[model samples]
Target: MSTDPASTDPASTDLVSTDPASTEPAPADRARGFEAKPGAIGSPPQHYGNPLHEQRLLAEGTAVVDLSDRAVLTVTGPDRLSWIDSLTSQAVAKLQPGESAETLLLDPAGRLEYAVRLLDDGVSTWLLLEATEGAALHTWLDRMRFMLRVEVADRSAEFATIGTLGSPSLAPAAPNGIALHWRDPWSAVVTGGHQYSTAQRHPSADWTYSELLIDRAALPEAAALPAAGTLALEALRIAAWRPRRATEVDERTIPHELDWLRSAVHLSKGCYRGQETVAKVHNLGHPPRRLVLLHLDGSEGVLPVHGDIVLAGDKEVGSITSAALHYELGPIALAVVKRSVDPALDLVVTAGDPAIQIAAAQEVIVPPDAGAEANVPRLPRLGAVRR
Candidate 1:
């Protein structure tokens, strides 16, 4: 807490490497018309051709995304499952092989430290992470391994990640004999998890997103397998109201702010680093902010970028964390706003050097008093005069 985390620690890791070689060759990025994402930690694609069409192809499950910018790590040895369950915000001890789960490691204050996608193939447990977090996470985990039977390894150099719309038809065991793909559990409330979102059905209920683990030697061929860039994946993510550590978490962020409990947190789980803060917030206090999906006015044909200020009239109420042009929904974004901001209010996202503002309509994803247990009391109207 001595140094300012907002500046020193980023919500997601972005690493710029000077190494001449990469898991996937640079020609792969150029072949797909990708422009390097500026200010991003790892070099990922901004887009390839029309992002809208690319999104459509991805939505239809015919496209693959080069996710080398993301990192993969493995934890093995006898105590792997119990060791992870003791430290994270998920109940993972009984996670069967081929099952997938998400977990978060938080600071004592409940601010997220690392968000991991967990999968165990009987022999090893894999953690999918952002490149920006790879080295730091590995170092931190290594330091915390005092007498634990778990062994950690940074597998990013050995394996690359691939994101796809639907589960690939690869056999339970890959032809190469590696059981590597992790099907996202965002499609439903994962076991031992709770949903804070009161929406009748989550927009992401149908999100069949899966991240496949492939060896570095196979990345070039995988990259050439009918590819789309990160832009396509980003658009669909926003449209589905999904939360990602790279885009949504800030220094002050808690799982409640983004309704991440749907897949990432377990309410009654055993103690962890930030259990006190989590329980206190869920039972007595409220998250300071709420997440919302915004339908942006695309008449100007300008889409706002991440970190743009969101204003309600003259006052700044929130900031857009992610924005995109969906294949069907046109321009849309996800923003986290103050809990006090009226859910019915119309907001504008201010963007660009010229300062163009896009009108936005709020779609309530997380309400003002959002919490795991739904027992909100009805307050009597204070100013109502009775006859």
Candidate 2:
């Protein structure tokens, strides 16, 4: 996905959408006094008039955010687990029913192609992903199943994703006999995964975000719950240092750059596409770029947008991949910058036409030497070696 700045118009394809074939608005879109988000990559409401209050309610697990624009795909057959395990970054060959796992699809070079949130209910494995990725991912998976028993199908029209900070009162849809709820794994390192952030206490330690899948027809019931909006969700997401594929990924992105190995990549997993590069970067070298959090100076009362240039003094060091105005944190952003950029340097983001610079305070998420986890011993200089 482009990760470009988006518009607030509800009908704009640049943000969010339901089924393209359905001309009618989604049930959630008809909520009382819904205000669509202009800059969201998917078409979800920005808020219900009181964004900050919504954020507080959401953080307290008293509110639900509509994520109907996210796509749902299903893979089934006896060969499903092993088949997908061999093709993606996660180790899912033995995934238990109702367990959640994240994975990535990469090119041979290990650059991100797609990011998927997976849940298996025994009979079928459900893949939840960005709406823009639905068709392409489904097509790719189908084509790759040349002789495998696995079958792939797009089920977005039948189900919708609803976001919450933690367990909500709303029941998940069980079209397949098992309730579908995807708990995010960002709060801690999963087994076989690695963490690159040096923070003594990770922000995601408090991130209880999860997605509940529901039948499309049940959206009105979901909307009737104490509801927040995508804007509220985005603010909390940024504050948690979560890496979302739709806004955080780009053409050159690799797992190491964003410290995605913490949840999405299995370092010791069996052979899979991009494993070589994943291994090489983690065990031998540092990623060229590192993800960071920027606490923007909100004195100007302006918030930056996606693709805004990040500057370290006069030199361009990075670009803001995601930005939001948090209820507690004020204006903040997630940016990917050159690993060499001094984390101590004050940064600036240039946003809007006839651009104005917004001062940013840097907070490192991925350190400069994030990889080389193997601790390979350095060889002594030939002449300095003791005889």
Against the true structure, whose TM-score is highest?
2
Candidate 2 regions exceeding 4 Å error are 1-42, 380-387
Candidate 2 local accuracy as lDDT?
A: 0.83
In angstroms, the error of model 2 at 293 is 0.4
lDDT tens digits by residue: candidate 1, 1-387:
011112222211121111111233234344432222322325555555455666777888988776767777889988999989989999998888878899999999999889999998887889999777888988888888899899999877767677899655422324234477788888888766767777897888769899987655665466455677777788788878888888788899999898887888888889999988888888777889999998876655466777889999989999988877666665678899999999888888898768887788888988997763545686769998766
Error of 1 at 150 (Å): 1.3
Q: Estimate each model's TM-score.
A: 0.85, 0.89
lDDT of 1 at 363: 87
TM-score, cand. 1 vs. native: 0.85
Error of 2 at 148 (Å): 0.9
Clashing pairs in 1: 13-132, 13-133, 14-41, 14-132, 15-41
Candidate 1's C-alpha runs over 4 A off are 1-42, 169-178, 372-387
Q: For model 1, where is the 10-residue window of minimal lDDT?
A: 12-21
RMSD per candidate (Å) reads: 9.1, 6.7
